[model samples]
Target: MTTCNYAAPPFDHPQADVILRSADRVEFRVFKLFLSLASPFFETLFGLPQAPDGATDQETKDGLAVIVMSEDSKTLDSFFRFCYPSTLADDPSLENLTDGLSLLAAARKYSLDLIEKKVCQALANPKVLEMEPIRYFAIARNARLAHETITAARYTLRQPLIPAQFSEIELITASELLVLLTYHKNCSIAVQPLTKNLKWLTDHYGGCDACIWLFGPYYKGSCGCGQVADNRFSPWGIHPVTWWATYMQEISELLMDRPSGDTVRTAADRTIQQVRSMGCSVCSSTVKENMTEFSNLLALKVDEAVSMIQLEMDF
Candidate 1:
């Protein structure tokens, strides 16, 4: 119920022939040509024959035709600002997502696809995804932005504790909420295997001195981290009991750390951080490669899971 007492400055085009009046009666002078060229709806509307009834028609100071709009003054101002030659907002990066939603509504009303896309681009910036995924996700879903929807979904997985109800719940259907909750559960389950096994690292870990020294004592094989000629031999040695135990604890903590990225990427990042801090160059390189490969597989699993679910919004 907040009303603006201050009038917004009109985005005046000196040669404009059309006046747009907002619901609050603020007037903006703009070029009919600009509107016509930007939107086919406007073009067709302006092309129609008009009555010469001056009593029913509202005229501006310079005798331009006035079109009253249902949108509020602020929305009309923002909408026209985007249509004009000037920049759309004082700081688009700092603008609220709700403001962008308003602009989208106005642009849609006029069938300004280009302006609608621009508003979507502005709203999908990195700052918005990081700062407000819930709101962004709600808008993105409704807008039919598939990539943005997925990005926002991934960002939500970064939270250790997600809410069942939030500010924009009215905009999100029960099915979408279920998809998000399932996505989180799937991501957590996706990386759970990392805690039990890490022998895959030895496949790519060359016989570096540090690797041999570190892994020799714990190798499931007795060849001192050497090439076992047997075809059945796994080049990668299994994680020792103690290392696996620590890894179990570490991976568990990282999953609860509200780690960002998909399950695979999150696991890979956390594992690399843990491996590098151990001060073992061999361990770091080995685990890095192994975790990356594992993450790829996990990514595939997520895709497979996603294919079975419906998260798309028709409109």
Candidate 2:
């Protein structure tokens, strides 16, 4: 409490019973009652037997006991805000993922159950989790936040595999990384069968006449454009429309790289071009609507399949 360089506001109440000093020498004059109520750590600390006359060599300033904390001023400021009554805002903005993780660590250290819960909720926010999911996953897994870890891991599937060098990799163990990789691999495997079966595409409707002419063996007449060379084996046990086959091929590759519904939702340029190039004017005129409908169903099916692949987290 030497020369009190900084006193965080809201916590700087003049009538505060104790002064919690940060590692950087900033002081937060907070009420012991609030801290004790919110944290068992503080309760136990204050319950300790006082020195004779309560005057042992514990640091003091202005007649209030000074408790030095290892956290910096900013972190303690956020922690105390949560410990305070509902008069203050319930949630404080943690500037970045690093700050969120720092607050989570501090909350856990102090055994502040409510604050830890709030921090976990904030960390799980989509805006926060989607920005850098792998980093969030590493940090959250290291912190042992099972929900946040799983949420972040799922978000990771929307992007390619984890890069070789990310800053937060040090926070997680090899086993943690392996679990996520396995989950991604499982999701990828799950979606492969989806693309291999054209029955889902044709189940609801008769084959498109344009597709049959341009892609299948029903080539009765041509609209001038030559038929696409669709020699690839069809999962439908019959030749799939060249355009549909191409679309499936591209999306299946995309799903393997990023095993998520999002991968198939955005139709590939190659598939669209292939559709437009079809000899059937009907297929070209209706490609937009048809692809939208098909891709939506495909994306939904991909999500359903991925949802079944459980991410095994060792919480």
Candidate achieving the largest lDDT: 2
Which 10 consecutive positions of candidate 2 have the poorest summed lDDT? 210-219
**Residue by residue across 220-254, what tens digits does model 2's lDDT show?**
44333343455443543455556666677788788
Model 1, range 1-315, lDDT digits (tens) per residue? 433233345456566687777788766777777678778888998898876676555554566787878888778776666666555334234267877878788888888877777777778887787777777888777666777787777777666547645566777788887777776666666544443343443433444333443333444343222222222222344333233234335545666434333544666677668667765545545667655664665455444443444444444
TM-scores of the candidates are 0.62, 0.78
Residue 240 shift from truth in candidate 1, angstroms: 9.8
- Report the number of the highest-TM-score candidate: 2
RMSDs, each prediction? 7.4, 4.5
lDDT of 1: 0.61
Error of 2 at 178 (Å): 1.8
lDDT of each: 0.61, 0.75
